[model samples]
Target: MDGKKQNKKGTGVKVALIAIFMIICLGVGFIGGSLYPLFQTSIFTKDSLITDQLLSKANVISQYIKSFYLEDIDQEEIESYTYRGMVAGLGDPYSAYYTKDEYEKMMESLEGSYCGIGVLCQKDEETGDVIVLNPFKKGSAYEAGIRAGDRITKIEGESVKDQDLNSIVAQIKGEEGTKVTLTVYQQSTEKEKEFIVERRETENETVTYELLSDKIGYIQVSEFDEVTANQFEEAVNELEEQGMEGLIIDLRNNGGGVVTTAQKMLDRLLPKCLLAYTEDKNGTREEYWAEDDEKFTKPLVLLVNGQSASASELFSGAVRDYEIGTIVGTTTFGKGIVQSIYPLKDGSALKLTVAKYYTPNGVCIHGKGIEPDVEVELPKAFRNSLDVPKEKDTQLQKGIEILKEKMQK
Candidate 1:
């Protein structure tokens, strides 16, 4: 009787919790319903400052523009003021609403096809330093002495150690043949040096592969572009045919591409179950999972660095959650926000941060990158050197060590 009573009490508690949840849900629904008509009917005037407080701001901005703006200030400048105010109002350092032109640049850069230095950037959580990892060979950064592990302390004298990754990249970017002065710090030293690197357009080579000693396959994913899945699939097929045992996916300096590419890669690794889902503000959720688990049963290692961001971080984080393989490198780039790229009627597009993403284990890497199994720092002495430093391959060495141990076992 006592046990039954206890069970009844627990059941009652659960029922009460469910009731509360449903009540809250209904309340939200009611409020949303109340607002829907207001939104649809254009109840609020468009030109009348969006918010009450903004009326004062709009007037002030109007006065300022009339006094200081060059020529007769057009709607474009006014709209820019509103956009700037929106970002400033959010009070979130990580979130920025990009304009059409800015969004186009972002999308182009994400796909690794951009008119700027071809490099990847991730941040140091402890120091808040933006790290440039593994600049593409013969690329501007590579030619300018930036390497796999170099911290960008400042851009044009503005310290980026406290700035967001996207902001730093924006400040550093420009047209081809133009120069951006970067104050870079090496991992081994406190002294920083200024490097004037010229900007250039990069035709992205999204994927590359190498056979390591006929038993290991080295696959490098520079970014997650539309073609990333095809390149990866082709790589796996080719490597498997050529006798491969271990695989290493180097995502160093890879500042994320497309989320869809990440899904495809996850499908290649995980079982045919739910891998991840994202929830939106309007209470919508979409699920994704692996298509099949019978693909590769071998050992895998994902190589990340300060610059491995977005979709790359998602892949590495998911694999880590599943315990499928080891992520060996420095910390990853913590850009977990999912941006929606919308094409306008014109040739332009808008990329806005709609929602953030999480790993299978529910880790949000928005500002904190994934920790590597083995933390590796490149040698400061050789970070700016032309050739790969002998002792600076801590991440790669750790990967090789772990792979060899797994092979031995």
Candidate 2:
């Protein structure tokens, strides 16, 4: 009877242990099954939640505006504004988004060929009125009685008052064979006159050269564009043929244009040295060097002023750093940032500031202009006088004087 009781007690203990083990396994399986669906959902959805949230909010706002706006709105313009506003929010003055038309017009301008009534216009600093710098002598504007010193009042009968100069200029540019009407007030006549000028393809006048004196050549580079380097070479070669012993490069008031054109010009002037280098946001440096062995060895003088900028600063800075030429005038305009244009798929573009450039000696002229070796300021009274004699243009006279001195050396 004692053995039988012991065996029954031991068997009961073993059965209790097995029951607890089965309960534990069931509990674990139940919990895992409950969470597996949730885990799968989170894995697939969490990564895109933020993107979905933003797009949902934008869609809601767009729908609300379209449904409750005061009047019918242009959805296309609204979409364009979104892009423009996004770029504007960056707070970079040089970063901009251009429409198809704007991009094409700008490219044409850079290419140094465009269809427009050939007249250079600028807003008068004091009057805030659009003034004609000059009508191209070979263009229809000149043939249509437009002249320098005329004030532009209207384009195509739309008053240009309170409009930006850039917009007005764009309005004047169009496809070849188009006609643009301009109403202008000529100071010579003291009356408003209208002219219907035909737009035609014309070469931009980027470089103008003349013989300042015997053996002294003067070349004025208005801006660096597609044709600038080639035009400059032609002028220099012609001057050399004329027994030119020295050269004066007038870059005064030249707001910079194409950077490559400036580089090409530097290659001709610099003697196998680093022309310039640019540093991007990634801390990568791109160095430009002069590959040409032949260079202009004659005495060279570069003229600059407060309006000289961008590529102008590059050209003058490199020349100054290399001791290749003497800069004569007031300080430059001090724009050292370089812009790169990226074209969009829809014929538009983004012109953004990509890098900051430094001179050959690693001097960054971002906010500080390159100082001239000889500082000479023109008098305010004679600043815009087209007929100002050589003796009166103090800055030009200084440049001539410096070039003559360099030639003697």
Candidate 3:
């Protein structure tokens, strides 16, 4: 009888606890329902000056312009200008606000293909000079002899001085087979040259592979994109089937595209270890690690240059820190910050820098680039000269020698 009483007491306690939990939940629900409308109004309150002063001012200005302007106003144009102006105020070269059309093109570019001459150009912030980063293989820009390190002087007879990269790109891109003449300062010849490149729908393939001497595989990664990691995997598999003894990854003039894509490629090549990490403004950190699994264990060499940035630095920096491969060529571009795309409802978007990346060893290459294990510089004479023989590329030769030595070891 005492045991039955104790069991009944325990059951009563559990029942009371459950009842209390249910009451608390109902109270929370009641409170939430009561405050829901207030919360909504607080966020969108027009009279809340402390919370929405800037937006209110903007609305006022827009209304005034619409009411008293001399001519009709395009609301879309005003909105675009406002968004662009706000992004420009950030003073960040990497951050940009894209209109719907521009955002579409940007998306296409990130997908490893676009309808253009297929040349990646970067503007020097200090010098205001536009330089070609890379000319896609078999694209019109490549066929027209445009190459990396070439300065774009004019597009369609208009001077490119003080023109931003987007404007220059817009002028160069058009319908397929439409010719766009460009004046460029050729880095190889140190002379001005003109080329009438026909604009076409070019697919910018990020990965290309070829066989090197002694069954060595040479893979060039032009940029990191959504499709790049898969392409790299296929290339590696094919090279392995071809009896490749070593591998050389050329990242010359490769301005980085996507961070996750680079991380995926690193996961394929690196051993089980910390590949990379990132830190936000709030001091929160996120790390990327690899498991001891199917990683490419062959002798490897990576080629980088001053143009290799962001994701390129992530790959090369981790490779050096982990001692996974021999990094050859000059220092990388040293862009450690990561950007995120926030797409607006109107098909527009904003690309903003949100966090900074670090290598596995906790080294940040923001302003200072990653130093290579073997430093090699390509001669300026062979920079933009597509016809230059492989023997003349000293950097490539150094990479090849390093890989061969590693293979022997």
Candidate 4:
């Protein structure tokens, strides 16, 4: 009987242990179910889940293309188009994705030095023809008898009508000592001409200065590049040496360039003041300032028009804010956003509109251009010409007039 009682006690102990195990497992299950939603809502997990979905979709599309595409695929071209599309989807005109070759060319352009038959050209708005603005004096194109106002119609016998400017430029640029054949329609001669020009490394001159009548200095800034700051300073110093009592800065048709170069140029002109500032998406602010070491104290006038944009607008806005100069001409192009180029490991780059820049007075001029103190319009007849004579340039004459008045004060 005692042995039977001990067996029942052992059975009871076994039953209690089994119950405890069941309860522990039930508690764990309840806790895990409760925390699952929290895990799904976590920042890290949320991003990962989205990324996984995107990858899955991309993989499916890629597999379909590989399986059923009719033509032989150029994988590299497809990859480049994919990246280009991704950036284009952002709907920002200033943002772009550059392939390896494109990125290299872009950097070369910003450096203001490149191996090419040096000629600056722009597509005529009304005629849709690429017109040569200026052929660098010592460059291959100039030596080959290319002149301003000539329309480029063919590159290497390929018709370039309606082609993109950058595409045409890329075709023109090549390895040093290479040759490029161009067919141009000369407007002055009213005849078509062809020439074969050799490419060479050329430095672009962005700043040009002259001492105008009445000791008024004239500086035309076409665009700001890496070499612009030093060139601008040299221009100013030379004009000052010539006893320049007043100045007129012509920024008409200037489409802008490197922002830091603009800031550097401003530093040479302004005394210890805030030049400009930018705020990124994260609300991070960066400020540019001009030190008090040097300042231009002469009577000043800045000329702008619809084409003066980006860094040019920044320079104009700062001068206006400081009351250092009188702005003459129509409103500016008003590109107040800033782009940051992020280089990838694969030699590609992404230029994104990362920030909105403001003037020293906290004015955001992105869509709304800066209005001039004295607005004057260029005559319709002189609009298309690359070199508008000072007498015919009503806007420039107004700037000169304003500077003279300021100097008389």
Which candidate tops TM-score?
4
Q: What is the lDDT of candidate 4?
A: 0.69
For residues 1-409, what per-residue lDDT tens digits would candidate 2 score against the true structure?
0000000011000110000000000101110001111122324356643367677988999989988999989877887777787777777655667778766654453232336776655444335456664466777788899886687788888887644343455677666777889898886799999999998765567788987675889898866655679999999999999989989998865656566778888888776788888887998887777887778899998888766666788899889988888888878766677655567767766656667888889998876778899887677665544334677778778877887887777
Q: List per-prediction Cα lDDT, in the order shown.
A: 0.60, 0.66, 0.67, 0.69
Candidate 4 per-residue lDDT, tens place, 1-409, comes to 0000000111000110000000000101110001111122326555453477777998999999999999999999988888788877887655667788865654453232336776655544335466675677868888888887688888888887644344456567666777888888986798989999998876576788999999999999877655678999999999999999999988776656667778889998898889988877899988888876789889999988766777788899999999999998888766777655566666666766677878999998877778899877677776656677888888888888888888889
lDDT (Cα, 0-100) at 97 in candidate 4: 75
Minimum summed lDDT over a 10-residue window in model 2 is located at: 16-25
Encode model 1's per-residue lDDT on 1-409: one tens digit a residue: 0000000111000110000000000001110001111122335665654777867877987889788978876787677557666666765443444556654543343332235676655555446676554467757777777765577788888887554344455566655567889898865566788889887775445688977773888797866655578888889889988888888888765666556667787787677756655555665655556777655678888887655666777788888888878987677656665544344443333334556667777777767778888776666654333235434666666776777778777
Among all candidates shown, the one with the greatest lDDT: 4
In model 2, the clashing pairs are none
Regions of model 3 farther than 4 Å from truth: 1-90, 97-114, 126-129, 142-149, 153-199, 342-350, 383-388
Model 1: weakest 10-residue lDDT segment is 16-25
